[model samples]
Target: MNGKLLEGKVALVTGSGRGVGRGIALDLAAAGARVVVNDIGASTTGEGADLGPAQQVVEEIRAAGGHAVADTHSVADWDEAHAMVQTAIDAFGRIDIVINNAGILRDTIFHKMTREEFEAVINVNLNGPFYVSRAAAPHFKAQNGGNYVHITSSSGLIGNFGQANYAAAKLGVAALSKSIAMDMQRFNVRSNAVAPWAWTRMVNTIPAETEEQKKRVEGLMKLIPERIAPFVTALSSDAAAGVTGQIFGVRNNEIYLFSQSRPIRTAHTSDGWTPESVIERVFPMFENDFYPLHRSGDVFTWDPV
Candidate 1:
């Protein structure tokens, strides 16, 4: 699992200063990758910056006899993202894998959410991946081979209470992953989205206002970030040759394949139906198939496996 998987591969893992990203960076390096540990070193809410975290991870990798460098560029900025990509190329000569793992949480009730809150989450979570991936697109095309792993979330894939921004951004990441997979498959470039359910700083920021929320948080605490890395490492390798355009999940030892949005149920009428007809026929027919307003916790009611 160490040198056999990713020997000589160069990887860039954003937000690698702590939590899930940190776990991933360490795993990639342990698997024989020359990694670019990129982190803005900001708070969980995506404020401030420090070079210490990234540098420390780099030091850790180096001390372990793996290769790595530190990058402090903001993945949300187009120019900075390009620079981050450049760091990989400069450090290891070429980048073979990109982990778009940088993100921030700004959870607020939809109605009460401000534009700033929504945009901030979108900037780091959604736009950051796009920026970083786009920056690496040319190199991937040039090499005619590459792997992209976008860190998506269940908040968007399923539903959540006060994370419209995070959810929207994460779901958009799923679409982006799919589109990239389709668009770049001809070039032998692979793109996939992963929704990692780990108890990281991100999960720690969730508001446990209600008793149910508190219990959910308690369940989450058992899911360590390290559990999420092995699957990601597998996906980042050539062993995942034909795996692209898919949404996967990792919670503790459990791996999941999520269902994308599709027409689960349909009703047909030979003639054009009136509003009344749709209500009477379609409403009754679709009632049983309707999805409940379930949060991420509601769906994953079982303890982490």
Candidate 2:
């Protein structure tokens, strides 16, 4: 129990071939979980797949005297997602933890964003998690316990430029996580979302043409992807049994519990509000509380510790 937080547990980590996913897979394996290192080895834009990355991570785990298996399957497809989960069960008898970390980017400003760009990001980032989690739902129900940790983004939680597609999908994931937690509570299945700030391959895509963008990139570089693994692994363990339906963030050594959407300011009139009245009364009342167009970087201005 001292060294093995997940002893006897079997975990599946999507996109485990590279970057943040790779770090998470390694950590989960080190924690005594037999891992299914699933990755299509897709590039940042979700094009092309290679088997090398997944296999290499599996080999690394084995070299460390840990158990892991490689699986190359696209999480975007419903059938393929199920196959990935089945790989875990086939190899380890049962799967106890799932980390939905596979994602793609097609960043473009709203005015210039194309349908293909939008759909592509949505399919992988949003639909992929749903497919994988849905596939695992029955098994979790049968076993009476399982954990899900989805890799979300602050782009959605806060806001970002040139990432409408990504933000939408990530925000949707947060909602999905919460809904899953509520629905599966009786079955002892838990779900949560984590927005990780790290200099991963995904973050590498951010252009640093301007000084501001360069600064953001520099700050991102300070956020080590591996730093996200500890919190995620702990959350996946039975030790976090009472923790579910939460949104968290990990940046460098900083772990944050983010606030969810709740009614902060409310206003009502004795009579039904007309559009004109609402504009006159409600607008001013909520004006101070209205969130500004601050990007994730803007909000986290301080250097990572």
Candidate 3:
């Protein structure tokens, strides 16, 4: 509730021209971070560019006495994405945080999904984070401290029908964050992800035209906006530095920290095994100790057996 939680910090947020990205950019600014707002000004389908959204967010931050600047960079390109981080350094002289929130949806069933559709989703949702985070990693290392939060989605964590392209790309983002966290632990650069279930323009792609689909949409309408921001803000804070390589479903006024566990193993297998024996004994462990597809927090635990 106190402003200035991020006082003196400089944050770069990608895809911050509108929707959830815009919300995060403004919130970070209000918390006293000088923000670089990056957006390609692209549409939901990742088409076209208009500088209005990024500029508007900057003005809003300025009007509210928060420091911010606009950046019109496509996240898919390494050069432009690097420039985005450079803008933060140029203005504030250092980078302390990054929110990889830029994304686009190119939904299609696997059968009907074209290579173009798949690549577009992967390039924006997955590769975009890759480019920005790659550029920011060094700066974070030099400073010896920083936070990185990637905006993932429920569709990726829990599979969605007709979202093969989007889901794969989002899951890739999660995987990328995990690797970054593992490598950056010694440098104090924490990395994590947030799986948001908010109502945004991205959700418009969900097929809610049918009555059944509409009911599902109405059910989700109960989730509030305030509930989503806290978890994301926490992930981008000093308090969450100890927590990395995780994912959280932030909605419904509560934060659920996701965890993954390897399936139990009864024995080491030989090279040649019988299918029946494997199915009866080995597969049972998978039923009980399966890792969560989406996870968060410290999974390494020591408990008395």
| Predicted model with the maximum lDDT | 2
Candidate 2: misplaced stretches above 4 Å? none
Which candidate number has the best TM-score? 2
Residue 143 CA displacement from its true place in model 1, Å: 0.8
lDDT by residue for model 3 (1-305), tens: 53857888899989888877888888888888899999878888999999999999999999999999899988899998889899999988999999998888877878998999999988999999999999998998987898999888767776667788888888888888899999999998888988876667777666778996886666555545445655677677786667899887666565667654343455456765688877877778566766565321122111111
Could you give me the TM-score of model 1 versus the true structure?
A: 0.98
CA error at residue 290 for candidate 2, angstroms: 1.1
Specify the poorest-scoring 10-residue window by lDDT in model 1.
1-10
Q: Please list the residue runs of candidate 3 whose C-alpha ends up more than 4 Å from where it truly belongs after superposition.
A: 224-226, 264-272, 279-305
Question: In model 1, which regions exceed 4 Å deviation?
Answer: none
Q: Give the worst 10-residue stretch by lDDT in candidate 3.
A: 296-305
lDDT (10s digit) by residue, model 2, range 204-275: 999999998898788878889888998999999989999999999998889999999899998988999999
lDDT (10s digit) by residue, model 1, range 1-305: 65679998999999999989999999999999999999989998999998899999999989999999999999889999999999999989999999999999888898999999999999999899999999999999999999999999999999888889999999999999999999999989999999998888888987789997798888888998988899999999999999999999999899999888889998999998999999999999999999999988789889887
The model with the greater TM-score, 2 or 3, is: 2
Arranged by lDDT, best first? 2, 1, 3
